[model samples]
Target: MWHSPSRRRREAGAANMTRAGRTQDQRWVATAEGEHLRGRRKRDTKPEVTLRKAVHRLGLRFRLQRKVAPRCTADFVLPRHRVAVFVDGCFWHGCPDHSPEEFRGPNAALWEEKIETNRERDRRNTTQAAEAGWIVVRIWECEIRRNVEEAAQRVAETTGSNEAPRRRRPAMPK
Candidate 1:
């Protein structure tokens, strides 16, 4: 019984798989939880898009996912104002309003650790950006969902571009 090179390599790697079927390098996650986590987008999420639209509506232009400091990439950056804005997911960033205080599952400990690490990294990144002379704004997902205009306003204000929001003109009857 001869196996192809690819098959042999796969077989060799199988030895590194944990009982949960994830490779040693991969963190263990419950099946349902894993699916949800995998489906999450790292960028251009709905809240981010809505915030972007609102910011643009406020007459502020920004660059998306720009790196303003070493190892720090902001979701969007107002280059002229030297502002770096980050839109963080509630659960991923351990939001006080949404993130669970205690995770429950086989890998519950890992989940808690991961969330904490995310928060630490977020703080570190914000500090790094600030140290590099960039104004940093961190917005929670719930805040954006609740009132995107407010979130956008916060960003605009941080950039010192708090111009009056553009108003729509009423339609004229023919």
Candidate 2:
């Protein structure tokens, strides 16, 4: 069964640790509880809400979590413009600028494998979308949090054009 950090800390008497006599057991318990809380908080973040509001205010029409061609479900899809936007979470997507060393702690091998797989999957998806002639825009959660307007403007630049040129496939060989 999963326990909340507050409950776990209380059960472990985390608040009563003396500065000089802090036992290894108490330290481990506190660290574990802190990591668990951080993971949960990251999962419940509201970056998508802010992005949606900003894009809407810019008068952009887009579909959320919509499926595009070849097994791609983009975070935001502008079908008319053939643009797909992805709002990547820093922790999950392993943001180069913000991913903490803690993510690579404990089960280092397992985390490396998992995060690498996620990165590869993102690359494959982006490549496939581009091959299908869709403009792909990737926005990191941290970037949106830092500046919603800037993130929205980046998205708008990709999809805001009134006339998107049609993509022509190569001519068939004889």
Candidate 3:
């Protein structure tokens, strides 16, 4: 196929037009919403770390960001007690208490759908983990920030049971 000079130039320019006018390579688009989304941390988040530290100080050590079942990697995984902890952000998770103005910005529908999907996924994951004999501990971000000690206490109470800590696998010979 013979390519005209104008056709080549047109094609070169098309490469720069990204989806939703987003920058190439997913770089920051220099918008408030864009910056907000980019700032979302997966692990080692402040709330997650605070809760982890609080729980640790209470002598309830657990694995961080480990999968106890398929498609469900908890923020804190207590294999001994078969517990999976998830620290959820209010805004991202669509907390009703959050200010409505937060979701009133550009692409509001997209944000609502995203948050709804997150809620549904959380429900499904909780059920799946329960069926697999694991307890799910969900702490709201505000709750963790407001009272980390209370969250730690909840974890302790949930895992502190008459049943001994059950090992997931047999101990290897040392």
Candidate 4:
């Protein structure tokens, strides 16, 4: 039978799809929304930027994406005081405020399992870091975005020497 090039291409593409659908361990289904969600970054998110800027303004400097343990890396690490900060995203980290089913879409069960796994991993990492004498500060995304200064202050207090954080002043131009 005669066929157009576009039609033939579509036919060939459709043949590659699995009739059985996704496997058990599949991360996301083949969809545009799934691809977009999968592309999210683990570090340097908007909340992280806001918190970092606030902390810097408070005269505090820390390492970004620093490795606290062999398996886990923290969002911010203060080597001097052994403090590790993690800014958890509501959707990805399974925050109680948001419903995972909404974000999960078609993969509701899979997404719930994934979120639970994430929370468990976070808990394990926190415990391990604490046991290693490292202070783990887990700040929620909403809290950081709502008041960056307050978040910075919390970090400073946790990592500081019990004194007020000194704000840095820019040098006057000659």
Candidate 5:
């Protein structure tokens, strides 16, 4: 079967448009000649990198993007702690407050459906991990950006096995 150039271009344009409105940069459009290209990182974003670095600085070791099971991968996994951290992109993961009213451009319906599917998958993964005795933590990109240290601290506290010491009551004033 043969496809016309206009149709192919339209399809490609639609695909590109799907990610257009989000704050992410599109560097691959200039390189790819076809509609479908594999192995390209959609949002190998900087916030995630910064968060990872911060976690590392806190002396935390983790597995990056480890596959949990069929059709799911945890963004960061601490096997010993049974903790999984997911650095969710505000746009792609449908952050209730941060996601745009509509996706990058005109293909809002498609993007909405795609994002909803991602959310459903995330829910399923969380459920599966919980069933397997893992603590799942999801941090939005915006949250990390707003207060990376706090977010890191939460992750550390959640993943750390050490029990927090109880506070003693102050002695009665004389």
Candidate 6:
């Protein structure tokens, strides 16, 4: 059957609408919120980097963004110790101490639902990793910022490798 030109054009345009287009079409309470959401980082965030450096200083090695289980990617993992670490943002992860109990504005319900969904996903990821024989260590952004050393210590303690291994330096060439 022959299709009309306008119908064909509409179909073509719809086909051209990709994920970026869908994201652009998302409804935000304010333009600034959209910008903020766009600016959010999925990996290598400041807290994650700080925690990684602190852990490194303790002489621990880890793989970044490794999947310990299906749909579960840890920020970093100590394969040797079978430990997976997730650096979660307080607001995003719905921190009991930091996150607000209720939200306001047009997208208030949406925000609450989003946070609840995030918390549920977090629980699922933790359980999946645990079932896969990986110890999950979740560190809150506030906790890291308040005392990164303490967070690092917690990770080290979880791995049961608090002491840094000695490294041998290369001798000077003759």
* lDDT scores of the candidates, listed in order: 0.86, 0.75, 0.78, 0.81, 0.73, 0.88
- Cα displacement (angstroms), candidate 5, residue 111, comes to 1.5
Candidate whose TM-score is highest: 6
lDDT of 6 at 132: 100
Candidate 1 has its poorest 10 consecutive residues by lDDT at 16-25
Model 2 RMSD in angstroms: 13.2
Q: What is the C-alpha RMSD of each candidate to the true structure, in Å?
A: 5.4, 13.2, 6.9, 7.4, 11.6, 4.0
Candidate 4 lDDT by residue in tens digits, 67-166: 8886989999888889999999988887787645455357677777778899999999999889888999999898887788998889989975765556
TM-score of each: 0.80, 0.65, 0.73, 0.77, 0.66, 0.83
Error of 2 at 123 (Å): 0.5
Best by lDDT: 6
| lDDT by residue (tens digit), candidate 5, 1-174 | 788655665756644433343221333223243134334354446777888888776777788887665666788787878888888888778899998776554444666787799899889988887777788988998999999988887888897666453456899999
lDDT tens digits by residue: candidate 3, 1-174: 988655665666756545454435444333676777776788899999999888877677699888767998888887888989998888777666762544565566666677789889888888888888898999998898778899988988889764443455878899
Ranking by lDDT: 6, 1, 4, 3, 2, 5
- Candidate 6 C-alpha lDDT tens digits along 8-125: 6566676544343433334433357756785799999999999999998889988999999999999999999999999999998999999999998666877888889999999999
Best-first order by TM-score: 6, 1, 4, 3, 5, 2
Candidate 5 TM-score, C-alpha based: 0.66
> How much is the lDDT of residue 123 in candidate 6?
98
> Over the full model, what C-alpha lDDT does candidate 4 score relative to the true structure?
0.81
Question: How many residue-pair clashes does candidate 1 contain?
Answer: 0
**Roughly what TM-score does model 2 have, to 2 decimal places?**
0.65
